[model samples]
Each structure stands twice: as structure tokens, then as C-alpha cells.
Target chain A: MIKAENLYFRYTEGEAETPFALNGVNLEIKEGEFVVIIGHNGSGKSTLSKLMNGIHTPTEGRIVIDGIDTSNEDQIWEIRKRAGMVFQNPDNQLVATIVEEDVAFGPENLGLPSEEIRHRVDEALDTVHMSAYKRKAPHHLSGGQKQRVAIAGILAMKPKCIIFDEPTAMLDPSGRKEVVQTIEHLNKNEKITVIHITHYMDEAIHADRVLVMDRGKIVMEGTPKQVFSKVDELRALGLDVPQVTLVSHKLKTMGYAVSDENLTVDELVAELCRLS
Target chain B: MSIIIKALTHIYDKGTPNETVALDHIDLEIASGEFVGLIGHTGSGKSTLIQQMNGLLKPTAGDIIVNNLEITKGLELPKKQRKKYAAERKKQLIEVRKKVGLVFQYPEYQLFEETVEKDIAFGPQNLGLVESHVKQRVMDAMALVGMDYETYKDKSPFELSGGQKRRVAIAGVLAMKPDVLILDEPTAGLDPQGRDEILGQLKTLHDQEQLTVIIVSHSMEDMAKIANRLIVMNQGKVVLDGTPKDVFKEIETLEAIGLAVPQISYLIRALNEKGFALPDDIITVQGAIDAIQNVLEKRAK
Candidate 1:
């Protein structure tokens, strides 16, 4: 559903030494897949997410979302409609004071019929399990609830794909769990494509594919099991392995015959029990 | 040097429709040099409780004695002499503030100085230290936060990276040389490496300087690794208080309260449920590995 070809992007005006935030990068995501991109700060993860949603046009290469070139100015809104984005801060992205009103803003901007907009708003909130908070003010909701409202706004547009740029970075642990589970549900039950960009190792564990970015390039890409197996490499890149993976790696280093293939806590424990 | 609270209660906008009972009939004490971690969901009253310790929020009822000063309720001066007593109260409040430095969440947003040196020196200067002493304190605080004074002294805080700006903000607090330090969500926007670096520095400060450190975080892993005591708050109440092991053992209760146990603790709990002989309170990766290794060794024997 998403493809990038030789994507070279830079922020520059005059007399700037460095221009390219992303340099000669190529990536592709299939439809109905959940993909997570992980990287350290300033590694072009956010820039790449923006490129996916037509927020930034590449200076050199081309980005095609469902065969629509992002450089086409006329189709930018269409691209955004198809590839919606949820940002880091819930407070900043939400535009309306009320919960249901905020969720309706996206579809309303698309000039949908009033009845259709209302239906979409209600459906989106139900999908996010936030129907009960529909009448509440956005300011009175918790961080997780607000983020879910943001997602509902995006979902109201009926986007085929949603790109989250560190959605849980600003939330508490419970809030993070709520947001992550919501995204997973959208991908599983709604058949919506998910592209999650984050620095959190645990959040990426359940993704169908994990893409590790470093220095504006795709350094590694594979299933969670495949990527997390390289414990030393991830640590060297300043990325943390999952807590379970870290424990498994330490056991292996300590001359224990533990398997390194487990990605979740349950799998790790099961493997240890079998070994015993 | 111990901080004590007895039946403390705080209500925001009291006597109004928008009143919020933030802290309710609370009681807590932290002995000198103890490291305490406070955890809760948003609006769980953790912030309100910490703000009270620094005398930023006055309790509606009950008593607070910090370093032997009665901070709760009004002072015991005569009504006619109350104005003079209020002046003295302000001075004492400043003294309490100096002894209890609070690095608010997103402390980077609080930085207002043009250069890092002046920013870190802001606290000490306010404490009326000599010019040379302020400069020394600024440098020492910078070092304590793992920032090089020579390299960052003249740089604008705005020009620094997110992590660097956060460190400079924290150095400003450390420059005050507070006996107790409370940080709320210090690692909110930081990447994993930056989070680890900040937590490591706080742990070192807690150990080497023997500073009474209170960290408010939602990350169970962070609390497990550093905190000697865990304080769990839910709905304006102190629901749980104990060592990390004791508190984390009630994983179901925490989960029900909209919190999560550390991943290691979750794993160990799962193992115990599966009829393994694992202990119930594993909170760290190293501890989990050691426990699994011991089990394996016993099986081999």
C-alpha cells in the first residue's frame, strides 16, 4: 500500500551545511499489514512518517501511497485521507473542545453529508471503545482517552491506513497500553493498515514486521523474532531489546542453554520450562 | 530530616462546584536518604501529594512536619501579630523550598535563561549565595547531571537537544543543593538511551549524595530498578506502600487500578502460575535470569 523510491529529503534554506534528513532510503509496506519502525532521536523516523502522509514532499525521490505520488499537489488531500496520521501529542492534534465534535472534524472537512459524518464519528468512537466519553470535554479526559479521541478523528475519515508517530511517547504506562491495544484492534478487526513509528521496543514486539532505522537508513527489517534476536546489534544502535529478550540474552551469556527465539514473556518462560 | 504527614487532605477550589479532592486523608513518611518511587495513572493524585511535601500546596486539614517545622494549618502566632508572622512564614517557606527541590514534568519548558551556566546558576543565586559560590554550584550541578560545564556553559538551552535541555533543567534544580529532590515524569519524551542515562544519574545522586529522592513515574521497570520504596496512589488515596517487591507482587491489584507490573514481574508471575517454582516478586531482568538459572541448576542436579 505504501512505497518509497530513493527517498531523499532535507530541511534547508540558505547557507546550511546539512540538508538531507533522509538520504537515499527505500521502503515498502503491503496493505493490511502492521509495520513498526524503530530508531533513536533525529534518525529520520518522524520525517519518514510525515513523508508517508504527504506532510513533506521529498526533495529528490518519490513516495507513492496506493499508487498516488505524494509530489502531486492536487492529490495531497486525497493522500492524507487515505493515509491518516496520529501525532505524538494528543493535546496538540485535537482541534475541537468536545470529544464527539473533534472526531467529526475530519469527515466534516471532507464535506460528507451531515448524517454520514455523524455515523462515521459514532462508529469511530465505538471502534476505539470511547463511546461513553462522546459527550465529555476533551480537556477533562485522561491522556489515553484523549489519544483515543485523536485516533477516532483519524478513523472517522475511514482511512485505509493510519500512521502513528510515537503515539504513546507522551502517555503514562496505562495510557500507552490503551493506545497500543487500540491500534492493534484496528489492524486486526477493521483490516486497516498500521504503520507505527516508535522508540519503544516492547510496543514493536507484536508487529507483523519490525523495521529498524539508523542514520536515515533501514538498518534491519524482519519479524519481531528476527530483529530482536540480534541483541548486541540493537544495543550497539542505542536501542533496547525487550525485557524478556534481555533476560534471555543474559542467561545465554552466563552459559545457560536458553533459547533466544522467544519474543514475549510467555514464550520466554515456556522455553525455560521446557529446558528444565 | 524525616518528612512526615498525618491525615493530610487537600481539596482544590474548595467550597466551589469545581472542587477536586486531590489528596484525601493521607499519611506518609520518608526517612532521611530514602529513595521512594511514586506511581499511578493520570489524575491518581500522585502529583498533588508530592506538591504538598514541598509546601507548594497547603492541606485543608491535618498536619505536615518537615524537618521539625509545622507547615500544616495556620501558624500559632497571635491574631494581632499575624502579619509579622506571615512575613516570617514566607522566609521559612523559601527555606523549605530550598531543602525540597521539585523538577516538574517537562522541566525543559521551564528553562528561561540565555545560557546554560546562568540557567543552572539561577537557583543558587536566588538562594542568595555569593557570586563565586553560585558559579561553583552551577558547575557542580552540571557535573552531577553528567553535563560538561566547559562545553555547555555558554550554549543557549534552546540550542541543546531534548535530553541535553532536560539535563540542564535538572542541573538548575541540583544547583539549589536541596536535601530532597522530587521529579515528575523525568523521562516522558526521551528515547530509551536518554531515559537510562537520566535514571542512572538520579540513582547515583541518591546513593553518593544520600539525597532523599522521590521519582513519580508510570514505568514499572524504572521503579523496580531504582526505588527502595514504592508508593501507589489511586483515586486520591494511598492504596499501597511497601518495597518494590511487596508492591509489585499484587500485580492483579495494580492492573485493576489501571497500572501494569514490570515486564519481568509479569513474566515471573506467569511462570509461577504455570506451576513453576519461581518466586513471586521478580522485578528485574538480572533477577529473573538468576532465578531461572537456579531452577535449571537444580533440575540438572
Candidate 2:
């Protein structure tokens, strides 16, 4: 579980008129819930991710991770353990040459026993479907494989929640699917809370809740159906919804009696059929 | 000028145990004015092929002849004349490469000059253009990429945002006025709006300047929108090359190779499978809307 109260962050530019990266934000995530945060480039999404993991403390607020305050310098390690993060670039997160070693790196640092580290590494690799690649070099793996390994590294830490900051941005379509599906599986089957930040609207289709951030604030928050139904609003914010949702909205605007709650292709098609 | 490839083969770390046949005798062509999209799984030889196209990477066993100049081959300079020959080849290669500018992925990181105007003027200045000509090119390139010349000229390259930095980096290449502009994932790290802005600029450049734009990207939506032609690579082979519709039609083939068709195509297929009888050939959201309308009209009939 994660909660933020009046979170505000600002980069110290020489000029006092520098804009805030995040300003007066409040958000809460329930345990085992899957949440996706979407926004434009300068919308403080990445800054929020860093703040959640205590990499960067909030400039003027508090973020509590599972009762551990992010501002508490002594509990920084504990907060990171509870809320692990996977970054945008696959090459950057992976710190080891071998797949299993990278996954075990976190557990090793936690000073877990050797046996426990090995066991956790294997389980994590199995969860990401990278067990066969346990001995391969990270450089030899594809972008998707490297990202899965990164997720496994986070999983080995046994975090209560994992925050992925644009994990699929650098991958090919196949790579993106592999990483997204892995995260979804961890959320659904493993019951690990997931906070995914992405620019890909289609990836948000199955999220339990979606948060739209703009200019360092939470502009919109709802279920995928609730959020994507307002396609024009998303467009006005320079954001987008899934293609099916966009088409459904277009039809409704064109005087067609299509349902607005259609987020997926199947749902949209069924809406069309019922209207006909 | 047209770009031609004949049995182009690039082998990485050749003669060693790690010899990789990156490109396996690939053949291709790009007319003077055409927009092409390259799609593939990781390590599918897409980058290898593109580098060879711009004469950046030489082929191991084949040749790429650009504008009637057989690049890096067929010129057997003797050891004594090698110095003179090398200088001549370097000058000619510069001329050839200037006509075919290649922008690597995340091109913004390539910017190094202190001012935006100087960075954009780097390529033309290197080509030994006069100061006045270079200044004209710097302003023209800035305008072409949708940047204000007077506003961004004195600004440092590092001061810009991710999207703006990328545009500035692109203008540096655009200043060269290449016949063919090949960009590798020009919108890799950009947000939706930034991606649209960059793609829009590329579309305008291709249309007005008659620039041959080849975009190497993984986004099916982007390729579907802009590229008149699409090239799909797999396992060091030109697996598919055709129009966007033609290339995206083989959904199973693409999926098998870890590539994907546009999301609209999936919607149409799902509808047909569910007995809605929607047309299966829909590729874009606009096309899907028209198809759904037709289905509704048919039901009324």
C-alpha cells in the first residue's frame, strides 16, 4: 500500500520562478490493486516514481509506503524494499552480467542467506519466464528479455509492490507485450500490487484504476472504462485512450448509439452488434 | 538520387567463433521520393540493414551502390596509391553520406554544440559551405523542424526538453538537406503528443521537400499512419516488403515473428469472429468506423 499527502516537488533552477515538478498531489493505492499512471513528458510521472521509492524525497510533502515514511532517512532501505521500481531503459536497471546474478543482487544486498537468495532468484526467474536464460549474459538478451530480468530482480526482493516507470518504452512490440504480460500476471496471480506508468494507452485497458497526470498533478483518476470513455477529454490533455475506446467515442459523437464503456475490441464489437 | 542494394551481406565479428551473419544477402531499393517504415523483432537485422543503406557499415560480401557510386567496394587501390585513393574516397563518401543523412535513436543525445543554431549548422559547416550559406541552412532547418530561429538560436542544446531536444537534433541533420533521411525510432522516448509532433514534421518534410524518409520503429500505429511502404525483417531476411496494408495483412506471420498488426486490425478481426460480420480488412480507426457503419446499414437492410 502507498499513500501520498500534499506531495510537492520542485527542481532548484537558478531562477526562483522555476516550475514545480509535482505540486499538491494526493494519491492512495490499496494493497494488491493494479494502478497505471499516464502523462506527457514533463508531467512529473517519473518524478513521482522516484519519490515513491525514496530515490528523491518530496520537496514539501510526505509519501508513506506500507507505514514506512519516505522522508525518514533511517527507513529508506525499508521503504525501497516494500516499493521496488523498474525503470524505462532495460540496460540501465540490470547491474549484473548474468541473468540470475542480477536477480539475486537485491536479496544478496539484503544480507539474506545464500540458500534463500538462490531460491528467490529461481522463483523470480520462473515468474518472469526467464529461468532458461538464467546463465546467459544480459547484453545477449533482447530488450524484452532484459526487462523481464529487471522485473525478476525486483521480484527477488519480495517487495509488497513494484512500480514500473515506462518499462516498455524502449522495447519492440513483442518485447512490450512480454514485459506488460509479466507485470499483469504478477499483479493478478501473485497478488503483488502494481503501479505502472506508461505512455501506451492500450496497456492501460486492463488496469484496475488509471490516473492521468498533467503539469505535476493528478488531472484524472478512474477505472479504465471510466477514464477512456472521455476520449475527447484525454485528447484535450494531449493524451490518448485505447484505439477501440477512441472509435467507440467517435461513433457516439457521430450520433450512433454505441456504449461508452467499451475499452477492449470485443466490448466495442458487442456494443456495435447490440446497437444494430 | 535512388538507393540500391545488391546481395548486401553484413557479418559481425567475422572470422571468429562469434561471427554473426547479421544481414544475409539482403536486396532493396529506395526511389528518390518515398517514405518507408522498417519493422522487426529485436536482433532481426533491421539496424544492420539500415546502417549498410547509408554506407555507415560495409557489407562483408556484397555492395550497396548509391547514386551510381559502388560504395566501399570495386575500388582496389594499390598500396603505393592508397593514401591518395583514401583521400579521394573520403571526399566522395562525405558527398554520398551528406545526400543520405542517418539519425540514430534518441538523436537528441547526439547534440553537443553550445547554441542551437551552431548545432544545426554543424553538418553544413563540416561540408565546407560558406558562412552565409550555413547561416541560411541553420535558419531554414530550424523552421523546417517547427522551431523558431530567433527564439532557439542562442539557447543551449541542454536546456531544452526531451521533445524539443529531439527536434533540434533532427534539424542538425535536416540542415544537410539529404535526399534520403533515415531515422531509427525517431520517437522512441517521446510521449504521445511529442511523438505526433515529430511524425507530423516528418510527414511535412517528406511531402514538401521531396525527402525520402525511412523510419525504423516498433510502433505499428505510427508506421501505419505515415509510411506508404513498409519493410518487415526477420532472421536476417527481408521477410516482408510492401504497402502498409499489404505488410500488415499477414497478421499470423507478423505475430509468429513477435511483431504485431495495428490495434484496429485486431478489433475488426475480433468482431468478425464474434459474428458481428464486420469487415476483416480494417487497418485504421477511421476505416473501422466506416466498416461498422456499413455493418449497421446492412442490418437495417
Candidate 3:
């Protein structure tokens, strides 16, 4: 539901010699597609996410969200409503002390009726499996729980897609799993579009497609299996493949008859099982 | 340089409704020249335990001895006796802090000086070192963290990249020349390359200087690569303590507590379960590759 045409963004205002944060990025995401973007720091993936939600307008080109042009000044609010964003820090996104109130904050700003806002808040909390914590304070929750609450807040706004920018970077391992699973569930069952940016390679294994960015450009794009099979290229770009993928690639290089496209442990195990 | 803890318990907001035990009755001993990895979930008392090492937070009831200096139960004396021993207590805490340097999470935010050199020189300057000695320590610390002294000394820390800013903040701690270095989530938000660079420098420093290094990290791969021992904490308790292999072998228990083993360990276990005969103890990708090659060679024979 997001489209970008020749997206170019730069931080310097008048310095033409300064490097662009995003240089010549052209992308399209169909409705309900789960896309993951991976890159090293300063790779401009975060810049791309902010552009999708209209947080940063392109300096040279344009981005259109669902038919709403992000560069248009008046439609910025409508664009944000159509595509919500959940940032890395949940504490920054949380607006209210109470959990349910924070979820209701979005609809309340949308000027919905009180009954409607309440209904949407409850439904959103239930969708994230956080109904039991509806009345608890946001600070008392774990990192994963806080992120889920932040997602619920976005859901209450009824966005067609959600952009997660390193949502698990600050969390522990289990917190990362919880947030990743929640994102997957949103895409699979809820039919919401997802654009996840992260440094964790394992989280990208199940994505519908993966985009590899480097030095402000979309260097690679393909299905998870198609992209992750090139282990050395990804490493050269300062990105990592899944551990299983790396192991399988190493075996294939050694002429072990193992499939190089294995992205998960079970798949690699099955591949080696047939070999012996 | 050695740290010994006995019956440590830390409670936040004590005697109130919000009273929560951040650290339970925990006991740990970290010898000098050892590399230790602390792993835990959010609110697992890992940070609390590290802060205790540097005397940043006092325990409610416990005894902590750092290089034979008892830090607990001294600052909490009654009002009259507390005043009587304030000077002695200050001296001991300063000595403890000098011996143990802590690089907090998001340490780059703690950088306040005007230039990179000034920021790195802050600790040594505070330690009352002479001007020439402070400059020497700053240069040495910068080199240790893989930053060039001449190139970055005059530059503002804010103008540098995220990884560079992080190195400068770490150099600020290293300038103190502590016997023990503790960092919390040093690689939290850095990219794979940045993470590798920072961990590589820590490993080198540990080897060359024989500095006691304790790092709290969530990346099991990093811990597996660098740490000689791993300590897993959960709900204010030390649930497991052993080598990376021993701790990661309890994968089920770790998962149940919101922690995870390295991804290679999962692969090895799954392969073994599927009758591939791969060794279940392998936790690194290279180790798994070697094990798989050995198994395949035997099968071909």
C-alpha cells in the first residue's frame, strides 16, 4: 500500500556536495505484504521508514501512501493516519500513564465518539493479547508488553499498515521474540501491511520479502530465501544472514550436497537428513 | 580487582506500595582477569548487580568486598556515626569507583565535554592526575578503543557517528585505568559491524591489560564468541552460571525465562533430534560447520 518513486533525501539544507541519506530508492508494497528492511547503521533504512509515514518528506522525489501523497502539506495528517509507525522506544510513543487511555488517545484525537473510542481501544488491546493489562500503568509493563501496547495504540487508529523501526533493539531476547511474533500475527491474521527494520537477521527469516540497503541505496531485494542465500554478499554489506542459512551455505560450499536456501533450523535439518 | 558479594538484596521504593525487589539475596564472585557475560531479561537484576560493583547503588542488606575493601554497611550507619565516618566512607567509595569503571547503557548520552579529547580526559582529570598524565591517558584510551588520537581529539563528540560517539564515551571510562571494566548493553543498538568492532576491542583490552571485563548483553552470539563464563539472571536471582556451552545447553529453561540460547545451538539440537547425529554441544556457526563436515566424512567412508 506504499509506493516510492526515485526517493532521495538529504539532511543538509543547501550543501549540494553533502551525501544523501536515501539516494534513488524506488519501492512498492502491495496491500497486506510483509516487507523487512535490513542494513547497518547509517545505511538509511530508518530514513526510508520515516519517509513512508511522512515524518520526512523526500528532498528530491516523492512517496505516495495508499493514494495520499506524502509531500502534500495538507494531506500529511491523513497520510499518517493511513500508515502508522511504532518507534524503537515504547516510552517515547506512550502518551498516557494508563494502558487503555494511551490506546484511546489516537481515536480521541480523530474526534471519534466516546463510545467508538472505547470500543476501538478494547478491540485493539484484545488483538495484541494485552486485555489483561488494560488497566495497568504503562511503566509497569515489560519492554515487549509496552511495545504491544504501543501497537495497540496504532491499531486503535485503524491504519492500513504499520512501520516498525527497530522495535526489538532495546528489548531482551524474549522481548524481541514477543514483538516479532506480534508483528507476524498482525501481518498473517489481521491482514495489515508491515515494514520492519531491524539489525537482527533471525527476525527477517520469515518475511515475505527482504530489502538490503547500503550507503543510502536499496542494494538488494528479493524473497527471504532468494536474498539470504548470498551469504558472502550480505556479510560484505555489513548485514548478517540467519545462522542456519550461514551453516547451510558453508556446507554447500564444501560440497556436502546441502541446500543453500535453508533459512531455518528445521529446514536445514531436513536438508541434511536427506543427504545422509 | 576481585569482587565478592554475599547476601545482597536491593529493594526499590522500600516500605511503600511500590516496593519491588530489584535484586534478591544474590551472591557472586568475579575474580580478576576474567571475562564474564551477564545475560538476563528486562528487570532481571543484571543492571542492578553491575551498578553494585561500582558502588553506584547501595544494597539494602548485604556485604560487598572489592579488592578487600568492604563497601556495604558502611555508608548506612546511624546519623551520629555516619557523620563520624563520612570522610573514611568517601575515601573508600572513591577507591572502589577508581578500581571499577562502569560504562552505562547508551553511554554516548553521557558525553558532555566540548571535544572528544576533553570528554575522554574527564575521568583522569577528576582523579587529580597532572596535565601531562591526563593527556597521555586520553591518548592511550583512544588507541585502546581503536580511535586515532590525533584525528578525533579536537572534534566534537556530537559531530561523530553513532559508533564513534560510543567509542569516545567508552574511552572516557578507560581513561580512568580501572582494574575492572563493566559495560551494560554496549552493543545494544549498534549494527553487526559496529558490534563486532566494540567487542573486538574489549577482547583485546582484556587480553593485553589483564583487565577484569564484565559485559551485560542480549546477543547470545556475541557472548558465545567472547565470554569465558556466562551468568544468567532472572527475577532477581542467578538462575544459571557456567560456560557459554553449559548455560546455553539449558535452552528450554532459558526460553521459559524470556532469554534465548544462540541460534546455532538451536540448529545443532534440531539436527540431532532429526537423527542427523550432529553434536548437540556446538553453539557457534564455525563449530557447527566442522561438526557437520566430520559427520559427512564419516558417512562417506
Candidate 4:
């Protein structure tokens, strides 16, 4: 649902010496695909997400969301509506006091009818399993709950795609699990394209595709197993593989018959079990 | 410095409709030179307990003694006598504050001085140290956090990278030379490399300087690797306190309370449940590897 060609971005104005935040990134994300982007800080993953959401247009080349070009001024709103963005901080994204009202804010901006907004809000909350918290204040909820409410807000807008920029960085383990599961459900069940950018390697395990970014370039791209099996390369890029992936890789290096593609604990354990 | 707590209870918005107990009648003792990892879900009283240790929050009831000084003793005095002893209490708290350093989350935002040296020197300068002593403290602090004194000292704190800026902010705290250091989520928001660098430096400081260190984190993997002792809090109370192996053994309890052991623990448990004779106390990847190797070799025999 999103396409980019030779994407280049630089924050500096008229400065040739300053490096580009994003440089020569070419990408194509299919509709309903769950794609995860992993990188170290300053790796331009966030920059690519912004370009996809039309928050910041490319300085060189272009990005197209669905059928609309992000750089096209007239279709900027159209691009945004098609690709909703959820940020890292849940408190900053939430606007209204009450949960349901917060979910309705986006649809209200879209100028939907009151009844339609109510219907969409309820449906969105149900999708995220947050209908029970509709009447509660947003501040009273946990980090995971607040993030799900934020996701519900985006869903109420009925976007075809959503770009989450480190959505679980501020959350605890359970909170991280909740947000990751919600994102997975949105992609598998709801048929929405997901572009999740995060530093957490474990969250990328269930993704359909994983893109590794480094110094403003797409350095690697493949399935989670295909990408994570190169444990040393990922570590050289300042990224980490899953703990199980690392353990399996180490065992392979020691002349064991473990699969290099093991991404989960169960997979690794089952492989090690066979060695006995 | 050692921290001793007895019946510590902290209630936010007390006596009001929105009153909530942030910390229950909790009791904890952290001895000097011990590296403690505090883990809990958000709003689980980990922060409340640490703040009380540093004298940032006065307990609604109970007493906190730091380095043999009863910092929370004055709070229990009657209102009239409390007023009379307010000056004495303030002086005692000031002493405790100098001995215990508490670093908040995202501490880089706390750096506001013009240069890195000035920022690190801020705390010592505030303590009325002379210029020479402040300079020595700044140099010592920079060395402790593994920052070069001559290279980045004159540069503005804003010009550094996220990791460097964080180290500089931590250097600011280290300049005070506290006997105990408490950091809440020290590695949050940092990349994999940056996170490892900070944690490695903290381990070095704990071993080399013998500084009593307490770190609050949500990552069970990190705690399992670095902490000598793990303290788990839940619902404003200490639910489990032991070594990482001991605490992670109660995986059911941790999962029920919205916490988790390291992934390696789960792997070992799964392997054992599948009829393998692996040890369940493993929490780190290396520990798992060694244990699994032993089991596999024995099976091969």
C-alpha cells in the first residue's frame, strides 16, 4: 500500500556537507502486509515513517501512499487519512479526556455524522478490546491501555494503513505485548497494512517482513528468519537478534546441528532437543 | 550507603476522593555496595520506594534511615513539633540528599548548562565546593561514566549524540559522588548498543567504585544479566525479593502481575516440560547454553 523510490531527506537547508537523514531508500509495501522496520537511533527509520504518513515530504524523490503521492499538496490530507500514524508517547497522542471521546476525535475531524462516528468508535474499541474502558479517563489507564485507545482513535478514522513509530518503547513488557498483539491483529484480521518502526528485536519476530535500516539506508530486508539469522551482521549494524536467535547461532558456530533460522524459544528448544 | 525502611507507606492525594496508595506498608533494606534491580509494572510503587530512599517523598507513615540517619523520622512528629523541628529535619534531608543520588527517566532532558563540564559541575558547585574541588569532581565523574574529559568537556551538551548526552547527564549526577545511586529506567528509549554501553558502565562503576547501585527497569533480560539481586514489586508492595534465578523461578507469579522473566528462562522451562533434564534456574542466554550443552552431552553418553 506504500511505495518509495530513491527517498532522500535532509534536515539542513542549503548545506551540502550535512548528511542526509534518509538517503536512497527504495521500498514497496504490499497491501495488508505486516512490515516491521528495525534500526538503531539516527538510522532514519522514523524519517521513513514520517515520509509514508505525509508528515514530512521527501527532499529528493517521492513516496506514494496507496494511489496518492505524498508530495502532492492537494492530496496530502488524502495521503494522511489513508496512512494513520501512532507515535511513541501515548500521553502526547491522546487529546480528549474520556476514552470514547478520544477515539471519536479523528472521525469528528473527518466530519462524519454523529451516529456514524458513534458506530465507528464502538467498532474500533471492540477491535482493540478496549470497549470496557470507553467511559474511563485516558490518564487512569495503563501505558498499554492508553496505546490501544490511541490505536482505536486511528482505527475510527478508517485508514487503510497505519505507521507506528516505536509505539511500545515507553511501555513495560505486558504493555509491549498488548500493543504488539493489537498491531498483529489489525494486520491479520482487519486487512490493514502495518509499518511498525521499533528498536525492539523481539517485536519483529511475528512480522511478515523485516527491514533493517542503517545510516539512512535500507541495509537489509527479508522475512524475520532470513534477516535475523545473520546475527553478527545485525550486531555490527547496532541491532540485536532475539535471544533465542543468538543462542541458536552460537550453537551452530560450535558445530551443532541447530537451525540458524530459529526465531523463538520453542523453535530453539525443539532443535536442541533433537541433538540429544 | 545502606537504606533501611520500616512500614513505608505513601498515599498520593491523601484524604481526598482521588486518594490512592502509591506505596503500601512496604519494608526493604538495601545494603551498601549491593547492586539491586527493581522491576515492576507502571504504578507498582517502584518509583515511590526509590523516591523515598532518596528523601524525595516523605512517607505517609513509617521511617526511612539512610546511612544511619533517620530521614523520615521527622515526618512522624506532631504538627506543632514538626514545625519546631523543621529546620533540623531540612538539614538532615540535605545530608541524605548529598549521600543518595536519584536519576529520573530521560535524564538527558535535565541537562541545561552551556557545556558538558559545566553541567557535570552543577551539582558539586551547588554544594559550595571550591573551584578546584568542583573541577576535580567533574573530571572524576567523567572518568566514571567513561567520557573523555578533554574532548567533550568544552562542547555544548546539546551537540552530543543521544547516548553521549545521557552519559553526560549521568556524569552530572556522579559529580556529587553519592554513596548510593538510583536510576529509574536508565536504558529506556536507547538503542541496543547504547543500552548495552550504559549497563556495562553501571556494572563497572558498581565493581570498581563499590557504589551502592539501584536501577529500576522493565526489561527482565537486562536485570537478569546485570543485577546481583532482583526485587519485584506489584500493587504497591514487594511481592518477591531474591537473586535473579530465585525470582524468575516464579514465572507464574511474575506473569500474573504483568511482569516476565528473561526469555531464556521460558526456553529452559519449555525444554524441561518437554522431558529434557535442563536446569530451570537459568535466566541468561549464556547460562542456558551451558546448561543445555551439559544436558545434551549427558544424553549422548
Local distance difference test, each candidate: 0.90, 0.89, 0.92, 0.92
Tens digits of lDDT, candidate 4, A169-232: 9999999999999999999999999999998999999999999999999999999999999999
| Model 2 pairs in collision | none
Give the worst 10-residue stretch by lDDT in candidate 3 chain B: B73-82
lDDT of 3 by residue, B133-236 (tens): 99999999999999999999999999888899999999999999999999999998999999999999999999999999999999899999999999999999
> Which one wins by TM-score: 1 or 2?
2
In terms of lDDT, the poorest run of 10 residues in model 1 chain B is B70-79
TM-score of chain B of each: 0.95, 0.94, 0.97, 0.98
Worst 10 residues of 4 chain B by lDDT: B80-89
For candidate 2, write residues A74-177 as lDDT tens digits.
99999899899999999888888889999999999999999999999999999999999999999999999999999999999999999999999999998999
Under CAPRI classification, how is model 1 graded?
Answer: medium
Docking class of 3: high
Better of 1 and 3 by DockQ: 3
Best by DockQ: 3
> Judged by lDDT against the true structure, how good is candidate 4?
0.92
**Can you give the lDDT of residue B4 in candidate 2?**
86
Two-way TM-score contest, 1 vs 3, winner: 3
Clashing pairs in 4: none
In candidate 3, what are the lDDT values of residues A170-227, reduced to their tens digit? 9988788889999999999999999999999888988999999998999999999999
In Å, residue B37's CA in model 4 sits off its true spot by 0.3
